[model samples]
Target: MPDPTDVEKARSQRRAWEQNELRDFLERQPESQQEYRSASGLPVQRVYTPEDIADTPFEDIGLPGQYPFLRGPYPTMYRARPWTMRQIAGFGTGPDTNGRFRYLIAQGQTGLSVDFDMPTLMGYDSDDPRSFGEVGREGVAIDTLDDMADLFDGIDLERISVSMTINPSAWILLAMYVALAKSRSLDLAKLSGTTQADILKEYIAQKEWIYPIRPSMRIVRDMIVYGAEHLPRYNPVNISGYHMSEAGATAIQELAFTIANGIAYVEQVAATGLAVDCFAPRLSFYFVAQADFFEEVAKFRAARRIWAKIMKQRFGARKPESMRLRFHCQTAAMTLTKAQPLNNIVRTAFEALSAVLGGAQSLHTNGLDEAYAIPSEMAMKVALRTQQIIAEETRITEVVDPLGGSYYVEAMTNEIEEAVNRILKEVEELGGAVAAIEAGYFQRGLADSAYTSARAQASGKRTVIGVNKYVEAPQKDAIEIHRNDPDVEARQIQRVKAVRASRDNSRVATLLDALAEQARNPSANLMPITIELVEARASMGEIVKRLREVFGSYAESPTF
Candidate 1:
């Protein structure tokens, strides 16, 4: 490390240069924005210098894959292999989605992400009156193991990684996945994928919750423990900040609250007698890459650093793999504007670049038409092409941590790391994530930040090209919207009813009764029973109904 006195001398000289040379130049040409701040509201300086991070030691910001992985998790990173091109795909029936999945895979997509419709996300059968017209409207509807089997038909589970984006009812989907793999005679140990089973985030932001908070957490804990024991190659829970960011959280709140949630999960599993290292290595994260390019990059760096320290120091994690934080990223859907939809292509490119520069392990770029509806086939292809252009054409993958030593990037990384730490401290004082969540601390913080952002946009403080500053004529007719088949609901209802009728009612009842009996025990692991229920052709609604009886439904408080 360099001497502190030498660093101070260099900083003093730089300050003199700024005062004498830069000040006179700035008087003639002012900046465009009156106040500079990140999407997270951290102050941005006109210029950064070594002095800004003089106290940050070189050892603290070490080489890639090292402890406190601020630089990058893997030393070679994209140089060895570009980030996994995972496209989020779903809309219509399982077979419909399976076709789209095959299309993307043939188009060079390396991984798959499934998005479930509202009813499936909420654990409702397509035949439920509550489902009505919502069946397969927003995403694919998976009511049973047959749907899951169709979703991955002709595709090898042992070869491809699939990420299912369903919460509140995530365990049901995982069970269906395991049962489908068994049907194919594939080893469960060979299957690799992630289930977005982070139920805590539902209460904090998305609100797609079913059971009460504590009981829901119990289900998530069961999944983690079961996955560690059986599905060694799979990530049972993808603790996500993507939804929180989409719901309008500042980047800092997203990182802080997410890490706090991870802390809570580690504690929950450890309390079950599983060591932190046993499960922490499989614990992956999902985050959003927003419009503020450099800030988003810095946020990713700070996130890895913070998680490394937390796992190593706070939890006393022994393994290096356990401490290293790995995450997947998606471009911000909230930032896309329907007005000049072509502009979203450029916006997504920049956001994707931020994730790459920040060392994302996998990424999904939002389609140009995503802000309006499910992407058309053309739009989805264009989105995948965008990532291909970045990975192949840009030549950014030639180096690791390409912007590691830049003054502005380094200073911003330090600033974000400090700010996120302070917020984590606050969360800790509130008795960890669950307590903070129950008290409405995380929710209120996000709400306030969202309000501030809305005000900024409304008052012209923030310039969103198509929404606020750059006016444009409406092109509702010109944009091609991907419409779900009108008969989808009727068809899904019929299929579900057929499956229910074919199964023996007596055996279904016995399995459900056993599930309820197990739910009554606080120490039971729910995955084994869930897998059995799914394998028995038990409908999603039947299983969810049984668990709901044991773990009552949740209703959020109006105030929070």
Candidate 2:
């Protein structure tokens, strides 16, 4: 810590310099912008000094793996092991995506991140009319356990960590994964992966939900308790800020709302007579690494500090693991531009670098051609190599929290943490995350921020390199756009139909009835029955339809 007398002396000197040398320099050669602000609209100072972080306690910014964990969650960070390189890949039929999965693994990718199409994500079978022409368009289509098997046919579940990006029907997909593992005689305790089963974010941002909010939270709670007792290594729910960020949340809103949601989950699960420590360790997060370099870094650091304090003070958690905030980051896909096409590579690289500096446990870099469609094979390879180059060539991982003590970074981290706490307090006053969502608080906040950002960009206040400032000519045939398989829908429909034909209809009907009965109880652990339903060859649509009959569908209010 700096001496108080010296700090005051430095502050006096800084004020004098600002009025004299700085003022004269600015008069001679003006700055680029009259006012500078972060992507989140936080005011950026002309220069940060020790006076900026004078009020921050030394212990709050202590060494890595310490309490409050502002530096990082682990002592070694990337030195003991590099962050998992998980490039999301899923398109067309299960087999088609399986090929891409194999391709990624062979290219030195360390983890699997699955992206599901609209049908699967909405809990519909590929053969459903609502799913026609949309099967496997955005991502892979999985309607049955057979599809899940095909998706991970050659991959070993025990060795690789798989992240499933689904929300509304996330538990069903998790069931399929567990059933597939059981069919192959694998131990559930040893399986490691994450499921984006954060239904709250769907209501708050993504708008891809099936059941009403309260019922959906019940299902999430069931999954958390089950994962705690059964699959200890698997992360049942990845409380995500990525969707909210992509949906146009500013950095402070993203962190605040995400932490608030996590608090809600912890409260709901703890109400089930389960100890916080039992399940909190496995609770994880997902965030987006945006273009604002320093702001994004500070966001991640503040995320850890805020979560640690919440777990320790609010929840009375005794274990260190319960307080640690582990997150996987993906580069902002919304920032990619189709005009220059190749410039996305540089954008993704910088975003990825910020994620590393902020201490992400795993990361996914967006491909160059993503602005047009799902990334092509070549584009994905380039994105994967981006992580490789950072890990092997950059030498950044050799040191832990390299920017830990920087004056600007420390000040920014403190400011972000304070801002997030204020938002969390507001959410609590509004009766928690679910109530806030129902009141359209989060939705309205997102809309307001998005509108502000769009207006800024349109008015030339915010400059996007290729899109706004550079004024580059549109390139033709600059990159290969990923084309969807025309027969993917047909093949997927046939596969689901075949599984239905071959399955035990009587057992499936009985299991679906049992599932409905248990779902009505409100306290029953649904994971076991859900797993059994998939094992009996029940389609995803059947399971979801049964639950929907009991839970009913959700329709967002338009007033917000």
Candidate 3:
């Protein structure tokens, strides 16, 4: 044989090459699965040369923010602006939330994402019997306008963007927000931020809500209309795929379901006869960054390209901004392990890296102590520091879409898009996402993937550093777990009672009666009455009860 060239010589030197060569030779004996691939399942070749990416032209893979937007959103992505740091906050009372907001701001956090307790999420006042055991259990308690006002007391609404996580009661929260900003003398137009007004996902994943589906959609439509007309800077809905992923959905399930839900929202609002381009620009998303680093990054790139194509091609959107999907990301919570909490730090780091690399607009790294409970200050600091190190110490932000044209990444992007489309087609066959969700398609998918993932973990096919490998003895020192003080409940209940006692009870009754009347009509948009009722200090339970009078409560069958 002729003398091997330098390229061939180098390729032959690697141990993996010999293994691959041996496998290639054994293919003659009997081939089982010719296509071995990544979790996203892009084909893994024995080696990649220029041949693998020959068809992926430079034009198709143009610089960031180009027509395709496959690489990144902007050419000078992080060089122009770093992704916003938004730690998911809100615990105890409004004053407590205020202090935490100030604390994060003082510590160099760039944005704020608020979390709410189970009662608040389900539209229950702290005084309600339903809210008794759960007041401020998971997050902050806001029973009326006073609590909402106190929540952002000194924080300048115009200066910093905020994201509130709430569903069925999203419009009430928005109304409270508007009132708070008005009290602070902030112009409605100058206000910025979002509300997790995504009700569809609640039925799909989170399972926290008050009203029925059609009525819930109306609430969302009202907010879309309000945000477009008055608060142009505000995102009325943060349509989330993050929680779906946290609920153990696979990456493609997260992508397809989120985009499908987005499609439903756009359609729902348009049914109200609003222009597509008006509110679509401000529509945002939240996705999880999981352990599959490269796949997660490519999924984001593919998401932008897909959404841009859908809005322009399918929805006939002319606005460039309508095509762009601005989103926030949090590292995968499902990946955390109580067995080896310290390993969580490294896990969060990798997932955060994936988020930044994936071009997330905002992010939150789950604290290591999250496996046990609410994070301690030390744990939260470590989580924040993870992002700072990646942003400042490492020079990853120097260029936009740094891995834009890697052959492996490009291949992975195509694979993920294809897989997500296949799933979307399956969803459509079931008569759209809502119908599919009702039929338990999403839950089934999650269950199957979760089972597979769990099996992998049990079999040691998946390597969790401290849990399955590099094992360590349990430490004698006790790690601190943050607990919500029970006084938050008493104070919240007392505050609601005080408002009920002092407010013009007749006007409150009148507004609530009107709400109940409109709610019974089913055709009435709840926003105007919701705003009026919130202004009148009607408790969340009162508003929920009004709706519940007409549309009966649902008992969702176990999806899996």
Candidate 4:
């Protein structure tokens, strides 16, 4: 920490410089803008000094791996090992996406992230009427255990980490993954992966939920308990803020809302007679690294500090792992532009850099062509190489929290932490995340922020190069956009139908009945029965339908 007397002296000198020298300079050559502000609308001073963080306690900004974890969650950060480069890939049938997965691995991707189509994400079979024409449009379609097998055909589950970006039907996918591992004679405890079972965020921002909040929370609790007891290496729920950010939340809102959702999950799980330390250590987070480089970096730092304090002070967590807020970062897809599509590569690279500087555990760089469609093979390789260049070429990984003591970064970190704490308090007063979601608090906040951002862009307050500034004339298409397989829906439906025909209807019906009976029991853990249902060759839609009969469904109230 800097000496208080020196800080005071510096502050006095700074005021003098600003009053005389800066005033004269500005008069001679006016600044670009009247005032400068961050992407979150917070003021950004012309220059930062030690005086800016004079009031901040030294302990609050401790070394990496220490309590509060402002610098980072790990002691060595990227020194021991670089973050896992997990580029997301999914489109068309399970086999099709599996090809992409294999390609990414061959190109040096360390982990796999699955992106599911709308039908699969919504717990619908490819043959279902609601799933027609949408089976494999946006992402891969997985309806049965057979599809899960095809998706990970030759991949070694025990050796590689996989992440599934599914919400409403996340449990069904997780069950299929477990069933697949078992069929391969793999140890469940040795499998490491993540299921984005954050139903609360689905209700708050993503809007892709099935069961009501309480029932959905119950399902998430069941997964947490099961993972703690069985799949110890797996992260049961990746409480995510990425959707919220893409839906138009400020950086602070994303951090605060995500941590609040994490808190809600902890409370729900703790209510199930489980110790916080037992499962909290496996809880992970997902966030978006947006365009605001410094703000994004500060947001990640503040997230670790805030979560550590919340786990230790509020939840009585004793284990250091429980307090560590490990997260996976994805470069913001919303920032990608269709105008100058290739420019998205630069945007993604900078965002990926911010994630690395902020000490992300894992990262996914967006493909350059993602603004128009799913990434082509070439674009995916470029995105993967961006991380490779950062990890190998750039020497940034040699040090931990390279910007730890910067006056600007520390001040920004403190500001973001304070702002997030205020929002967390508001969430608590609203009776927690579920209650707030029901009251449309989060929805309203997101909508307002989105509107504000849109207005800013329209009025030229925000400088989105291709969209609002440095405009360029439209030209002929220069890059090929990825197109989904036109016959994917038919193929997926046929595969799902074949699986149903091969399985015994009587056994599937019996298993689903047992699952419904267990689901009706408030104290019953649904994971075991769900796993059994998947193993019996029952489709995901069948299992979800059975649970829906027992738990009903959710409908969000409209908010202006």
Best by lDDT: 2
Clashing pairs in 1: none
Can you write out model 1's per-residue Cα lDDT over 134-226, one digit (the tens) per residue? 999999999999999989999988998999999999999999999999998999999998999999999999999989999899999999999
Candidate 4 residues lying further than 4 Å off, grouped into runs, are none
Please report, in order, the local distance difference test score of every candidate based on alpha carbons.
0.90, 0.93, 0.82, 0.92
RMSD of each: 1.3, 1.0, 4.4, 1.0
Reference-based TM-score, model 4:
0.98
- Give all TM-scores, in the order shown: 0.98, 0.99, 0.92, 0.98
Total clashes for model 3: 0
* Models sorted by lDDT, best on top: 2, 4, 1, 3
* Superposition TM-score, candidate 2 onto the true structure: 0.99
Q: Please write out the lDDT profile of model 2 over residues 187-284, one tens digit for every residue.
A: 99999999999999999999999999999999999999999999999999999999999988999999999999999999999999999999999999
Q: Candidates 1 and 3: which is better by TM-score?
A: 1
lDDT of 4 by residue, 300-354 (tens): 9999999999999999999999999999999999999988988999999999999
Off by over 4 Å in 3: 1-37, 40-43, 57-59, 476-478, 520-524
Model 3 CA lDDT for position 175: 88
Residue-pair clash count for candidate 1: 0
Lowest lDDT block of 10, candidate 1: 1-10
**Per-model tally of clashing residue pairs:** 0, 0, 0, 0
Per-residue C-alpha lDDT of model 3 across residues 411-445, encoded as one tens digit per residue:
67767777888887787789777787778888788
What lDDT score is found at residue 522 in candidate 3? 51
